[model samples]
Target: MNTQATPSPQFYLTAPAVCPYLPGEMERKVFTHLVGPRAAEMNDLLTQGGFRRSQNIAYRPACESCRACISVRILVNEFKPARTMRRVLAANSDIVGTMHPAQPSTEQFSLFRRYLDDRHQKGGMSDMSALDYAIMVEDTHVNTRIIEYRKRVPGAGIGDQPKGELMAVALSDLMSDGLSMVYSFFNPLLDRRSLGTFMILDHINRTRTLGLPHVYLGYWVKGSEKMHYKTRYQPQEHLTPRGWERYAEDGGV
Candidate 1:
């Protein structure tokens, strides 16, 4: 028998930086590397404990003075789209997402660049190069997938890949109990499509189909207008000091 022991993951804390979601606030993160043969199992545990994966790292907010970043996960089995959400789904009925192994390509990078240029021009990821994008999508150790969204073809079957202009992309992790949305971007010009909301709704459905119970939606800052959309998916659980608890829009359990 082999007499080897797995090394424990070493955790680290990042220095403070300007907060991306809140103004005049600084942010810090506590993180650990997710690698080795146990990566997938570790990811499931860390994600359940409110950490989010980026490449090979699993990190959570470690801000000194702020607690606005709350981890949110939707109850896939219980999710019911609101009228507006249904409208978004109907608007994007022509769009279909196909999951594929995590691989980087020039086409994805080009769309990523356009998305950053139009929607996140001043954001932290705006300056990411093609190499950076590749590393972001390809440097993971856990079970990950790249879901490419395109317009559905007239004769395409459910299992066939759609052939049309690439409309959106979601980099997601398949966890033990849920799907974690690592990142996603879409064509900013298609503003009316509401592709962002559509993608989340699709993930919920996907999770349900996979027999999973949750769709992890990363952090949702209370006052951040950019994050407010995450709250629209009701019956989600918020990570608290006590543990995951059901969140209500009216501020009650």
Candidate 2:
């Protein structure tokens, strides 16, 4: 009979670094490795506790003086697309996303490079090589998936695979309670299509279809312009000192 007890995860704190979302501020993170047979279970628990996964590590903000980085998750069943969101969906009607195992491809890397060059040329990931990108997608210990978004080819049968131009890709972790979006990128040329917002809407729909209750959207930093979009998705819950509570734009509740 197996009677050995499982080892608990050891957490580590990252050194303070310049805040990416806010100016004149520093950010720190508390993290732990997610590996072995309990990886998936640990991921779900850690995520529900407000941690965000990157590769095999689960981390959350450990800033000393700031609590602006609030974890946000959409209430999938109660989500109602606003007119603007509905417009985004209609704009991306021709694009379809297909889920596959978390495997990287040359084509995806190419698109990723373009996205970084155009949108995040000065960001930390700007210098990531193809190998680095592959590791990001494939080095997961939990249930991860890569969803490829492409334009639907005309006359394509239901069984036919999408062969049109790749528009975007999403790397996500499927948790027991919800889907956690780890990373996503899109073709910069299609900026007018608002592919980023479309991807989030798609994930919300996917979560609903899977009978999941939430679509984890990672952190929404207050005062961060880059994070403003996350707040557009109404009826979401934000992790607070009290716990996950419904967020009211009017500042009630």
Q: What's the count of clashing pairs in each model shown? A: 0, 0
- Score candidate 1 by TM-score against the native: 0.95
How much lDDT does candidate 2 score? Answer: 0.93
lDDT values of the candidates? 0.93, 0.93
State the lDDT of candidate 1 residue by residue for 172-236, as single tens digits: 99999989999999998999999999999999999999999999999999889989988889999
The CA lDDT at 192 in model 2 is 88
Judge candidate 2 at residue 145 and give its lDDT.
Answer: 99
Largest TM-score belongs to which candidate?
Answer: 2
Q: For candidate 1, give the lDDT.
A: 0.93
> How large an RMSD does model 1 have?
3.2
RMSD in Å for all candidates: 3.2, 3.1
lDDT for position 233 in model 1: 94
CA error at residue 198 for candidate 1, angstroms? 0.5
lDDT of 2 by residue, 78-154 (tens): 99999988999999999879999999999999999999999998999999999999999999999999999999999
